[model samples]
Target: MSGLNAPISCDLLVRADAVVTQDAERRVLDDAAVAVRDGVVVEVGGRSGMEARYDPGQRLDLSGKMLLPGLVNAHTHLPMTLLRGFADDLPLMEWLEKHIWPVEFQLTEELLAVGARLGCAELIRTGCTAFLNGYLREYVTGQVVADCGLRAVLGEGFFSFPSPMFPSAEDCWKTVRDLDARFADNPRLRTAITPHAAFTVSPDHLAASFELAVELGVPWQIHLAESPSETAMCLEKYGKRPVELLHDSDLLGGRTTLHHCVDVTPDEIAILAETGTNVVHNPASNFKLCSGVAPVQAMLDAGVTVGLGTDGASSNNQLNMFRDMGLAALAGKVRADDASAMNAQAVLDMATLGSAKCLGWPELGRIEAGFPADIIALDLGSPNLMPVFNHVSHAVYAATGMEVCMTMVAGQVLYLYGNFRTMDIQSLKTEAGEAAKWVLAAAGK
Candidate 1:
């Protein structure tokens, strides 16, 4: 054996009756096969072509499923999965002030870890292979990601409030720096500078975050123009729109990752596209919060690298990218009055290749030859996916998370036959249940 001490041997060859490679051509092959070794796709073609290729130690038969690239969550608060459905049916500001903030105030490091394990499990269960996460707890995120074997860009939420981990802004900076150093060598993890948002962070702090991101060569992820109230607040406080404030602060660039441009203008969209600033659209969260739908078609038309994200469970109530894609198409159709505004194939790309670009990962999205063997297969026999006339349309409009039958990331099978391979589901459930009780108790409910 080699000295690398790898987690698992992924000499896996996965075959399916229907394989839809979300590649340059949007190709889908019937009676297709894929060869994976050492965490990357080596071959993808007809079954005969793959049979002529190098043999594998294992094979997954997915004859009745439609295989595609693993879904990517471009933005989310993973640890908030425990808080799913805890608070709902309110506007953004009131919801934050009355419920989310108060509950967050009592979260402990252990609780965050417990919640992250549960979130990872949920993501795996629903075929989400990679996700970007931001939370008030940093070390916990790093540890859980490393242990759970998921791709993540971890960022500690920083604000003016006295958080549990940091007392001052300096303390928060120091903590994030330490986290960055700790995960510097981890391949499955990376670090980002998250300032929460414009309304929560001071101008000086926002500038510092961008500067630090530049210095450290990490992406800066921020919430911007998420709601009209946020826009109003930015104008009142900084005499400019949220995007303008960010652009003025020199924070809009290739290394900048913005969540929700729900209320941005055409000019701001142009600036973002020109600067190569990546934007992630959370259609579900925006709709739930009554935040106006983002001008996604306009941004895409302007050549912006856009992706899909579920936001967080507290707001989204789920971390399913398929659900997010369905919502995106629904919202896009209603807002643009074009039923084809965001179609199934397009939303599928947004979850795979588009989401990868937003996350600064160029090589981890598609199922093409030489791409990572990150893939998922959904059962087509289900009622939602039955009588498949158009595979793409069926996936975007008819499919649901409950139909996911397999999830593979980095050539490793994370979930199959309804069993998680890497994470301990029972332990996570037990720990998460206890932690949720504590969080609720601390919230005095």
Candidate 2:
């Protein structure tokens, strides 16, 4: 449709010094260029080859930066950023029952919006272009994510018991249906059916939620076996382990992702592998909350897909995937009693493609033709990243969250260096600070 010398037009061209494709081959290309059209990657090759074929309307030159797929936070409670550091230094139950739940119960839509905006800022700045979020009133978070241009799976968390948002379980199911219908056409927004946890949500409700998720063709996730106490409670209440209960309820499958399997046994790991159910390992949150380490090595060895997450800012205090990756690798080694238990590449994979798998988004977490243009650029000249022996090693072991200079989702640049292009960071920070103060006074913290 064009003359011989006229190059094909594309929406944008992103050229970088080196690109960690994270593709099937995990190729690291030098002087790489990615051509994007309509938020999809049209082509990826050497800079000259791409330039010669495509004429880009806009160009971003990461001359001294390394590009890679943006990290995916497999599990999180986004609005909990307002609860960060508010209820620390206590046991999990006390922290939740006395402090966290009290504040969550008192959260208004305004406060939730403020916290979601602040959390979205942090996620963008830290190179997370996609995340799975579970919370109450997730439509508010969904609206914020839609405005911010981030890819997210938002779910309204429900339990068998009455809560502030939903008086009955039927109310929660209606909310889920409404969310699915509302976001059905939005490419970047998705709805999920989420029960709060195995211990809190009864078996009948859990099975019903799973059926609803299946009916809607969406994801089903829950907090399962997060602590020994939770496993004990599930056993005492249902005479079955958490995983066993879920299996009995027909809740384990490829579309399901369980967060924080810290207390899972070997048999449970096998069950996960056999069912093809995914698991999200929240290393920092587990350690911070004194929950035991997840047997990630065992899970990975058993062929169970494992992903990485920061849980919630309230527990992990930050949604930085780099920090979580470093901890995952280090803690994996410590847990396995081997220096090379979970390698750099493996942990990086967990944060990228592995997490993408957990979110049921197979096309993301990779840089390739036909993939969405969810990518990030890091300043390669950072002091800690210097003397780069290997790109994956540096990314996993040495790189912190601060090295991210640009974060793009669906070909839209949401963050550039220290600037947020989608939202007003200063205004959101002011509102978030005020909301935190209100939480302090209202929750009696």
lDDT of each: 0.84, 0.91
- For candidate 2, report its TM-score: 0.98
For model 1, residues 1-445, the per-residue Cα lDDT tens digits are 5344433233877888788888889998888988888888877889766765545788888889888888899999988877888889899999988888888877878888887888888888888888878887767977887886778888888876666666755577777788889988987788888888899888898888778888888888999999989999989988999999988878889888999999989999999999999999999899888898998877887989889999989898889988999998888878778877877777888888888877778676778888878888889989878787777787778888888889887877888878988888888778877887887787788
What lDDT is obtained when candidate 1 is compared to the true structure?
Answer: 0.84
Displacement of residue 112 (Cα, Å) in model 2 is 0.2
TM-score of each: 0.94, 0.98
Tens-digit lDDT string for candidate 2 (95-145): 899889977998999999998998899999999999999999999999999
lDDT of candidate 1 at residue 16, scale 0 to 100: 86
* lDDT, model 1, position 208: 83
Q: List the residue pairs that clash in candidate 1.
A: none
